[model samples]
Target chain A: MIAMPDQPSRKPLVELRNLSKHFGEGQARVDALRDVTLTICSREVVGLLGPSGSGKSTLLNAIGCILEPDQGWMRLDGEVVYENRWLRGNLRRLRLEKIGFIFQTHNLLPFLNCTDNVAVVLHLAGWKKSAAIARAHELLADLPVDHRKVAMPGQLSGGEAQRVAIARALANRPRIILADEPTAALDSVRAGIVMDLLHKLAVEQDAAIIAVTHDEKILGRLDRIYRMVDGALSS
Target chain B: MNLAFRDIRHKLGRFVLTSLGLSMLLGVVVTMAGIYRGQTADALALLQATRADVWIVEAGSHGPFAEASRIPGDTREIVARMDGVSEAGSLTLQTVQLVQGDRRLRLQIIGYEPGRPGGPATLIAGREITSNRYEIIVDRQTGLLPGEALKLGRRTFTVVGLTSGIVTLSGDSVVYLTLADAQQVQFDLAPPAARREQARGAARGSTDLVNAVVARVSANIPASLIAAEISRWKHLSALTAAEQETLLTRTVIERASRQIGLFMTVLTLVSAVIIALIVYTLTLDKTRDIATLKMIGAPDRTIIGLIVQQALLMGVSGFIIGTAFVYAFRGVFPRRIEMLPADIAGLFVVVVLVCLAASALGVRVAVKVDPARALAG
Candidate 1:
């Protein structure tokens, strides 16, 4: 773990040590992540600030269980999931039970309405259809766009779509939530609203939020912040 | 919560129109098969109606549908004397085109003795032909009612009866007449041709010529034995009813059936490729959606299920519409379109297999999609 110089100790929800990833081979190779180490406690909202192509997205993807780091020791909720190699054979089930992702654009299925958009993940997680839908309504009721729960993705504004996407991420009740540019498409005020909502959800759901973005204006909402330069992170 | 169904519901109008277009193509395919079946049935129908046990054709001839066979009309009397022969009849068969009112009708004229096995087995309307001359019984498809006068060449025959389902090998309606009238129609030349023939010193063919002499054999004695006995005669050949049917189907119309079969094969292959292309396009449109589903931890089987299910729905709906169209237009079709339950069931199974094969391309694309792409955007 990275040396936390004046940080208060809390129950760690996510931990990474000596993680490295690179693309291509020989002279064409480019290192996207280098010995990245970090620790995130439960219910904490952390901001990942980096310039374009600085490996913020790569780090987020690795943490989201979608990318496999070449060498790494990673843990989620005190369970070692990777040690130079993946420990879990069923990575999909691990991702479903432990991780949630909020995409840059609200990638809601156009065919399903907002309620179904949120409920689909829960249904995949083995919840009964009616109960999953009921839980989806409950999550939507807490968000500002609850009134438009029945609306389709095309019928919703950018801010509203993001809100539905948020409900979807939390629908599976994952302990580790990864958001990539969660509020990039919104105006400053709407961006602040989304950040505030994420912070509230982070505490209320008792989940760790690691958001990767370049929007420094909303950095004040995060409880902790880390900056990445040249694929290495510095707090 | 089937994902395929939801997508279809979202674009129901486009989906329905695509299925409609596919259904018509499938309709042509099914109709072609039905036509082949109808041809086979028509060939069999003629034999079923005649109910003859053995046929005495000319020596060295397959006759009469597959090849030409002419024997003297008096051969029936000689055949009736054979030990196992129960009844024998001479039939004069010829295809003639007649103009009834404004319509030119092509008909198969069959001449048989009134009480013979070669006559029409049943009449749906009016009385059977009683007179040996100038009287005819026409199938209902000929559009001639009883009491209607059908003029053939210089002779006008009164339509005294109507029959249904009595068709020739080529699906043309049959018009039955007495042996003498049919022989007159088949053998007698027009006045001009007769005069021209006389000037050339070419005597006309005998009016006593019959296509073949049909006979009924005793039930206990096999017809093949009587046929074997007749084959010993120098000027005669005998064919059991079974041999005639086999010759008709295997040689006379085999090439035509094969042509229809070839057409069906080409159409089915084309349909498979069209379905594959259509399904591939649909999968391409949902690349991002599929990635999102993958990123959300949906299993690979789930993605495959969605694509395959959509293909099945298209194929099944198209098949139903095509079969319905075949049924709808069967009455107006000039030839019979006959399909047995087994034929329909076989076609349906083939269609399902085609749909499964067609969905293979889409399934490949779906399973290969990178879930990380959903994060990139």
Candidate 2:
């Protein structure tokens, strides 16, 4: 059990202790993740810096509950989710309830308009249709892309779609948000705007956010920054 | 569910086009199935019209439609003498060309006893044959009506009654006549040929050979047993009504039925391929979106469900349109296409299975999508 920090007894929203992941076995084996430990307290914006093949994605996947680490102790919001073995029950529900993600591409379903695309996660989380849409509208209204809420992803500009994606990630009010190269597709100006938006969301929602990027311009906005090299992390 | 439905709505044009194509294919399949069933119904109609429990034909020959069968007309009397036989009558069938104005129409003349086991049960128009000499009852399809004179060999017969749907196994129009008149039409020579034969001093040959003897058995008596007993006489073959229908279905229309079966199989395979291709293409188009969804914590099953739901929706839409098309165009078909509730139900089951199988390809692709692709430069 993690002891709550004395300052208002705030708990770590996400904790990764000695997490390790290896791909394949025998001569072809590749160690994608070495022993790595990290903690993200509530409302903290943590930047994960890495070059190509530095295991940033592997770490993100493990933290996001998409890829199980071969050896690890992972706690989300003070619950031991992975310790030697994955939690067998409701991993999907856990992700739906506690995790959000944003990728480089907007990744909006082309068939759905921006609002519907954002509302889909809330729907999966079992919110009523009216309530989910209401929430989606609220989130989209806050984002810079709300003006295009009725437009499909195909109709939106690159920056507008990315903003919509950020709004979608915030739809379920998750405890933690993981963004992998979320601004990689945008120009520097748009990339700075997206990073600022992520920073604002982390502080306003009081949600821990781990954003993995190699972009130098956005690193200054993060409250804490860690660099990954050869599957290990260094501050 | 909302996402799936929204996806379909957004791609409405492509979805509609695909569904229409699938509907046309399904319609052809349904029509072929209906034709097979219709042929079977027509083949059995002649047997059903006789309303007999047993059929007695020549040994080593199938009766009525499959092959030629000839038994002496006196065989009916012999069959009637059997212990369980109630009544027995001879039926003869002969196909001939008839002239009406400038049109030469093919007609299948069926000879039956007027008030016995081998006549049509009801007449749609006019009256049943009261005189056996020159009166005829014709099916409506033959275009003959009461008071019309029909040329049979050298004699002219007055059409007395008209029946509906009395088509023969070969799909030719049926005309019912008395045994004697049918014998003349079937075996009697032209006046010139008869005169030539008489000049040669040839003995007159009896035209008493009939296609088959239809016998009605007593209630509670097994028709198969009576048929077995008749088969022991060596001169004739006997079949229960059920067996005769099987022979007619299996032998008479065997080639056409097999051809239709083969066509249906090929069509089903083609439909499956088309569905798979369409679904796979759609999945390919949405790959990046799917990767994005996965990166956003959408479960693999969720993505799989979306693909499968789309496929099933497409199939159901296509099937409904196809069924409607088949019903709408039924009348325009030259051959009878009889659609039955059971046939539609069976086809529906097959279509559902095909859709499920076809969707497997898309599901596999969706599940294998790499979420990391969403982050790749």
Candidate 3:
């Protein structure tokens, strides 16, 4: 257990109520999620720990609006976003404007340079090429290896690639960042650096973060921890 | 960001190799078109070289190529005396096999009067035939050089001149001979066959027959009028030079033209299949990246555009390279290969359409990629 922060309480930035999801059918069916409920406030770093097939990934996908739950209610920034079914709006737009995702492996496109990978999101958000590129350069300049902005993903080191992925996730300045094992592939030193970066991003940008990870060593630095077993969650 | 170009640059070697392979296929397509054009040109080569205003053949014949139209050889003199006739010559066309050393070569033997219509035009080497006996002018395609001796029937003829682009409607190499020699070659039979025919009580056909009479009309008179006058004789048919060309191309070479059309269709389909396979393979190589893009909130159109743009680039590059390859080696082909500018432009349009169609397969694969897969790893 990690001690909770003593900051003033605020409405949850993201909320899930009675979320249920199942896969396959009959004897092959698996209840990936069972009425899971959770909440994380803005400017908070929450860690989720679970073994393989414990539904951590399923819950992340549901929150990211990529997968639908069999029965669910989801609220973001205290506004109802999903009830019985999703609200009548573009889910893709919602994801682009309100959510960010970082994968276990650095999923930067191998073809584009670091800046381009980051700028592509801004481009999708209707920014002009010059403005998006400027914003990409600004975000990259804040990273430790700003000189790698022009280097392709294949040319970047593991740490540099992860940092570039982080820059891409933050480019749109979404309210929520969903990270699935973002530090699972890093060394101890690089993992610590990444945890610190995520912590700083939550506080400075006022964004809520849910990091689904298997690394117990990094849990000490998070504000809260949730454990999932057999499709149920406990904090 | 231009992701297509970026991806290509990232895998420059693979992209270039694929483009090279595609270009060879495209080169074959280009060469096929050139061959069709060459066929048409070869069909018209002899007619254009004759430059005769009118041609007179036996009645009920559709020119000398489509059917045998032998008229009396003395018809040339009678046509020469007609009004508006500047010069008239007897022309005899026959296919003959000539032997040189151990090689046997098939040639379209054209017999014509010296210093008149129906002879090889524009010599590439040596001089035109000055003698009417056993001297011949051969097209360069016959693989004969000046002063080379070739056997025609029982007699040996010396090659006195070489001509370029002289071929029959069927793309056979042409050799020019005197009307008298062609008549003998056409009418004379082997000794045994002649003896057998005599014992059978069949007199040999007249050797004084010519296939057609060509006339160069005066500048002031229309060749059509002269042709109309010749048709009045009721025993012969006359056609203007344009009519003869039409008769040869549309009638004599009609089957070949259809075969080439079918060949072009097959090549185009093959090119489409090749492009489609290459695009599908390339898409398969990038399925992971495509899934990531989907997860990142990139719209399906963006991914589709990436694929379509790459396909277009490959098509254009292949077309350019193929055109260059064909052009550089055009003359080396045994038959003429004609690549016109208009034809190349048309080919570019066709290649772009093929690429568009080919990219549809990749687009189908990309659009089905599940974005959730990005979270798995």
- Per-prediction TM-score to the true structure, in the order listed: 0.94, 0.82, 0.91
How would you encode candidate 3's per-residue C-alpha lDDT over B272-370 as one tens digit per residue?
Answer: 898898999999989989988887788888999999999999999988998999999999976678999999999999999999999999999999988
Superposed model 1: Cα runs more than 4 Å off: A1-9, B189-195, B200-205
| Candidates in order, interface RMSD in Å | 0.9, 2.2, 1.0
Candidate topping lDDT: 1
TM-score (0 to 1) of chain B, per candidate? 0.96, 0.88, 0.93
State candidate 1's DockQ.
Answer: 0.68
- List of clashing residue pairs for candidate 2: none
Q: If both were scored by TM-score, which would come out higher, candidate 2 or candidate 3?
A: 3
Strongest candidate by TM-score? 1
After best superposition, candidate 3 residue B135: deviation in angstroms? 3.8
RMSD vs true structure, all candidates: 3.2, 5.0, 3.0
Looking at candidate 3 chain B, the ten consecutive residues that score lowest on lDDT are B186-195
Q: Please write out the lDDT profile of model 1 over residues B28-128, one tens digit for every residue.
A: 88898889989988888877789999988999998777678888888999999999999999987788876778998989888899998799888899998
Best by DockQ: 3
Candidate 3 chain A, poorest ten consecutive residues by summed lDDT: A1-10
- Global lDDT of each model? 0.88, 0.85, 0.88
Per-candidate total of colliding backbone pairs: 0, 0, 0
Cα-lDDT of candidate 1: 0.88
B346, model 1: CA deviation in Å? 0.7
